[model samples]
Target: MVRLPLTPAEVARGQRLGALLRRARGERSMLDIALDAHVSPETLRKIESGRVATPAFPTIAAIADVLGLSLDAVWAEISRPEHDVTPAASAHTRPERLTA
Candidate 1:
């Protein structure tokens, strides 16, 4: 399968997703979260570090569930904003933190 290169917008969104998941993780160990999410620690690490710019949906959903983030919130965090809103710009705004 040929995978196209990610656009700048996609890269930006992936970074935002990583940051949001990291914040929601708070004080938890990455290993613990990764194990609970049924993903390898390295996989989680890559996602959190934005090395995997466009991860599979199931992978993200599992990680988000482990972090107690709603899909809607995840979308809001990573999706491009319309009108005057910018996803990166919105990242500057504080979001509700999640706890284990």
Candidate 2:
């Protein structure tokens, strides 16, 4: 099977996901959490570091379960559109065009 390169948006999303997971992890040791989630510590480390940008669904599910995070919440958090500026903010700033 062939894998395609990830877009910048995907990379950003992965970073956000990793940050969320790290915060949710609190003071728990990565090894303990990984063991509880039935995954290798290295895998968890990679996920937390955003090295495994798009992890397998099962792996994410397992980690979410161990961390007591709802899949819906996780999806909502990660799937939010990246808004560079609010409507009011955008009104104040001039839009710039890029020339190749």
Per-residue lDDT of model 2, residues 35-86, tens digit only: 9999999999998898988998888878877887766656656676777312
* Candidate 2 colliding pairs: none
Give per-model TM-scores. 0.79, 0.79
Q: Go through the candidates in order and give the C-alpha RMSD of each one to the true structure.
A: 5.6, 11.9
For model 1, the stretches where C-alpha displacement exceeds 4 angstroms are 82-100
Best by lDDT: 1
Overall lDDT per candidate, in order of appearance: 0.78, 0.74
Per-residue lDDT of 62 in model 1? 88
Model 2 alpha-carbon drift over 4 Å, by segment: 84-100
